[model samples]
Target: MNTPCDIPALQLSERSFGLLRSLFEKETGIHLRGEKRHLVIGRLQRRLEQRGLHDFESYCALLQQPHETQERQHLIDALTTHETYFFREPAHFQHLREQALPNLETRPLRIWSAASSSGEEAYSLAMTLADTLGPDGWEVFASDVSACSVWQAIQGLYPQQRLDNMPKGYLKRFCRRGQGVYTGQMLIHADLRARVNFFRHNLLADDNKLGEFAVVFLRNALIYFDATRRGQIIGKVVRHLRPGGYLYLGQSESFSEPLTSLEYLGGSIYRRPSCPAIARST
Candidate 1:
């Protein structure tokens, strides 16, 4: 008579909770707050069932195996990927399309969606840039710590409702409505999908090889990190920004202390001073 919903959730003990959460923080730099205990249990419950593990303690043991890379990624994906949709924040894109690109003298016009979850933000940036830049060469690089999210993003498939916030023009220009057995689904247009590159990257590590970008959208995801880690992440990420480049954060995200690297430009936007201005001021 017990339905799946009626089945009691897997119990996570205080010791196992501390161990698993610490492992998560070490690998991903996200501070799993104590209040997120229920969320963690609910999200990770299936993983335990599928692994044939009876409890959270056993799951924690499996996670400790060095060769369990896929399982490790599953943990990260389950915990870190929050709800994201196309054009979630319109102002940042508007700023890029209307204000930043106009005055920008950079040749390549490279941009990074530093926390692109499921590729929505990156694709949004790509579509906006491709529409504006036309045949001119440009780059939109996006990365996430969640391997599963990276895989989903690379597929570029979504339910049609995901486009609700997308402008009519972009929907026509950048997406193809599904047909046949795939009804109610939409796919990012091949050209638009090709414009945005997706990869798996953890912000806790500095990937200097990605080179410099003219703008980096670190956005709303920073709220998951603690203050010290937030500063460390910002400092490392700023190293990738070209001089005069801009950084956009979520409107809700703010620092506990001043950031000496970038000048705050209001509306949660910050700009790095150009080389000439830096030299002149120095």
Candidate 2:
């Protein structure tokens, strides 16, 4: 179909907003309210033109085509914002380094960066774990709902400013400062990037054969969803964690329905009960 180049000031109609909302919810489980109408259209408009489409209506029709599955992927790329940086939450990293990693030495360690936005969080986990384990055989998998984020994570390159809050030791050890033509940017070492596998996944969707993980980081992302959906997503993730594994939530997020068979290990951390440690919650 012939499409027009993007019109920067293009207005989004109610019908267009509805189409964007449906696509977002289906792909990412993030329900965009009507208030975010402008945000969605503005961000995605340029991407439509990049794909050589002139208008949102044509993009919508493309998404509807059965063989245009790749178009839906592009829609996700355009719509989702991967605004993330290294060490985004310091306390979570501290806890992982001080408590979680030390406690996992006896077991085969596998961590899931469940809401790995832009790959920084997952790479951070891999760096911390690799530092602790030292070739002790551990794996980290980072997954995100955003197709663009997954691609960037795999690329392993980022702006230098993203490391503003990162510790000097970590900056030196895990990342190479951008130089020459690559000035003002940094890239994670291939060794570290090799340790993390980035893939597309929606938390609200069926669990793929993810196997089992020793720890699952389902932070920050839950804030976007309402309580009921959050609980459903949490329940699904916890099942893929092995017994005695850890589930970490965002500092501000809390569980309304306390998960059974998990011991509250203080703060927002919970540990799966090992064997007879279950205590019924009244």
Q: lDDT: which candidate is best?
A: 1
Model 1's number of clashes is 0
Off by over 4 Å in 1: 1-4, 276-282
Q: Considering every candidate listed, which one attains the maximal TM-score?
A: 1
Q: What is the lDDT of residue 38 in candidate 1?
A: 85
What does candidate 1's lDDT look like per residue over 133-191, in tens digits?
88467889999998888899999999998889999998988888999987999999887
Q: Give the worst 10-residue stretch by lDDT in candidate 1.
A: 273-282
lDDT tens per residue, model 2, 1-282: 112544445566788779878977887777888888777767777777687987778777878889987778877776666666777778888888888777775455889999887898898888888777885588899998877788888998888877888778988998898799989999999888888989888888886599889899988888888778887898889888787788888778775776665778767888876564574441
Q: TM-score of model 2 relative to the true fold? A: 0.89
Task: Enumerate residue pairs that collide in model 1.
Answer: none
List the global CA lDDT of all models.
0.86, 0.80
